[model samples]
Target: MTTFRASGPPPAADPAVVVVTDLIVFAKHLRLLDAARLRGVTPLFVFGPETAGRDLARHRADPDHPLSRVPDGDVVHVPDTSLETLLRGVAPWLRERRVRAVLNVGEVFVEAAGALAQSLGLPGPGTHAAQVCRNKLLQRLAAPALAPRWTVLGADRAGDAERFGAYPAVLKPASRMSSSGVRAVAGPADVVPLLPEYGPGELVLLEERITGREYSVESLVRDGVVLWAGITAKDTNEADTAFFTETGHTSPAPHLTPAQEALLLDANSAFLGAVRFGTGMSHTEFRLTGGDRVVLMEAAARPPGDAITRLWRLATGMDQDAALLDLALGTDPVTAPPRRRARQVYLDHPRGLLTDVRADDVPVHWVGERGRWPDLPPAAADAPSRGHAVLVSRSRGDLLGDQADSRGRSVSVVLDGPLGADLDAVARDAARAVTISAVPLTPAGRTGEAVR
Candidate 1:
């Protein structure tokens, strides 16, 4: 069959940028939105029904909420979440709005963004690239040499004792993010119960866990070239439990040996290339094993989560959000020289119902000194804290030991300061100053007496 191909001269002027966001969480693209406005780019925001309604409710309830501050005309709502439906709905809207690019800042919206870009002939990393980055099995398959040994098995096979006789393997949904449905399978028993979390025929990855320090490399790529890359030191709850929940992170990781650094750069380059990742911001995680071996964990085509964007700006004087916006608009990304060190310390709390939080004792140097208590949802897990603090210090100190807590109830903090600042000491003092009290939750889901 002969196919007719459409050919035309390029437009003299580029279209505006549109960002598609979701409702699972708050809109994290506010900084990018503001930057686009400052650059005379009135970007339009496309939100799904869930996200748009939630944003409206949140803004109405709290006037200071970022969504409340957005102009009414700048928002558009799409009812469908499926990639094909979303593309069909958005492609016409983009052409109508003269949108030059479609930016997907959240994991849920990446595939849609790629589809939109392809249909609209805009700049993007393509749908296949996004899928490779999203699915763990695809990532491992794409870069087997860089990734640790892993196997993809259906729910039924996940419980096979002989298959996973290798204890200490990590089991997770092939394409899930934010550690959802992720667990450590020390034995066969641990595998069976968690298999039901996946659908009847859903695929899961059983990976041989690499023991070592965990780190994430945040990079900005333009035309398949890594423009800038920075390493962030990560601390997780691995020592005390099988769950690898993140507890803290320090940017421009000051402890990487020369060999480890070399391995990281090499592995990241190889993995990104293997996946055919072309443009936009990416966050690739790695583990530095005892023998100075670097093992690839996974990567995302979007920006890093967990306030890493703010940490990057604090540490390197570069606004990653802004860089992403520029890339979406096909402009040169904003770059800056590294100016200081940055760290994020997540407060750990015992499993319970939070009753009261106090940060009065927190030192004056902490950035978030407004004494605001974090909003505690009724059935929320004590793992991630909403009320954390930020500080900019002058040096790095021995803060790791001081911030360490067996129960994991310490408040999280993000800080940036000069090279010689005693950040460790500052962090220790901040940890000592903050106190959180919660009522223990019994196995029956009832609240008990308050505990500190």
Candidate 2:
């Protein structure tokens, strides 16, 4: 008897990674694609049914979108975004290629990505961490020490809102993002009415309103080790509305004593450990009480949204997107310390039918050098103007609603300068630069009203 080994040439295609997310995230953070390209790895995108439909509509409406160039062959449309469905759908397709890692860039479907990575023996945020990141209730259960007193309420249990731990409580959708359907309830009576806002049978978290300054921590971890971490101070619309929608963010958290910073990091690390976070960036929001106690608001297994990653890149000179790809590819990421302060401020308009939007022509004084930034706001393409770059997320005819959540914000202005620069003043100046005109709608949300 003779033992024989049969072998052939290697696979013709380049090594690849599975990216489980939609196009919106890629459109905002195009550098993630650039990172993959720079590493010479193919990114096979897997879009869920809902995302596929939304992406198709957006592409048909505007073929010039940043992510419109993705080759169709590299795209995979799945029936749904569940872990089992993703594995069953993509596993066979992946068998033909050398898949390196699985990554999720969207707010939802993190557990699906984590489980996919685990099944492939690749690095990810781990199954437990991903699941906890997806659900507010799971987050509370996973890290009770850092979580505020919280109770669960669903459409069927609307009465439980009255038995909540305290008054002036915050009601958050158990598994939603961008602060959608989240509001501050004044009292027990106020809770039942708001229940209708959420989808029927949706779980809601009723937590004691932890009063304090809110901040977010973005950390890059690999193999359970934190490589880089930074704190960002944030301002929310809670003062102007019942919802806690983030209106602004300052990187490096301009004001943090050494002790306070240490406490925040400790709490974040504890939460990650409890959740068994494995790899990738974690965005953890915290509220520091008057007594300096750090309370966890929520955490996500993906990078921070709303271009906070860009702020981090500008403030630290560390391209986290590159680091993220490096982590996925089984390599250590290089990081840099904070160099300058950066802030992003969102602009909102009066509730009405938007008629016109304009910005004063001002020279965009490049703080250090010109063309150094990769993805400046959309307004940057028009002309050099101001110390900030403005990006409008709405059109002239689009209806403007109350600044209740992230979706309601109209425009965004981003600015960065020396640590001593008065960014708040710059932000004010930037806000004044833009003019918004709208027609006042009737009280019934009809257009048969006066033009304002």
Instruction: Choose the strongest candidate by TM-score.
Output: 2
Error of 1 at 218 (Å): 0.5
Across 1-452, the per-residue lDDT of candidate 1 in tens digits comes to 11112242235323457787753333434666568768776566677755546545555356655555556656667786678667655554444445666788777777778766666666677778888888888888898887777777754574454476456788867877777666777767777777777787677888887889988988888778888888888888778876777777777787677787878888888888888777788889999897568888888988887657776776666767788887776667978655666677766544455444556533323212221222211211122222235332111111222222222223456555664566676666656665555555457766543222
Minimal lDDT window, size 10, model 1: 392-401
Q: Count the backbone clashes (under 3 Å) in each candidate.
A: 19, 3
Give TM per candidate: 0.81, 0.87
Q: How many backbone clashes can be found in candidate 2?
A: 3
Off by over 4 Å in 2: 1-10, 49-69, 154-158, 362-374, 377-386, 443-452
Candidate 2 structure quality by residue, lDDT tens digits, 357-447? 5666633322111112236432211222235566565556678888778878776777777676677887888778877677777666654
Off by over 4 Å in 1: 1-15, 23-26, 49-54, 60-66, 88-92, 158-161, 361-411, 439-452
- TM-score, cand. 1 vs. native: 0.81
- Model 2 error, position 39 (Å): 1.4
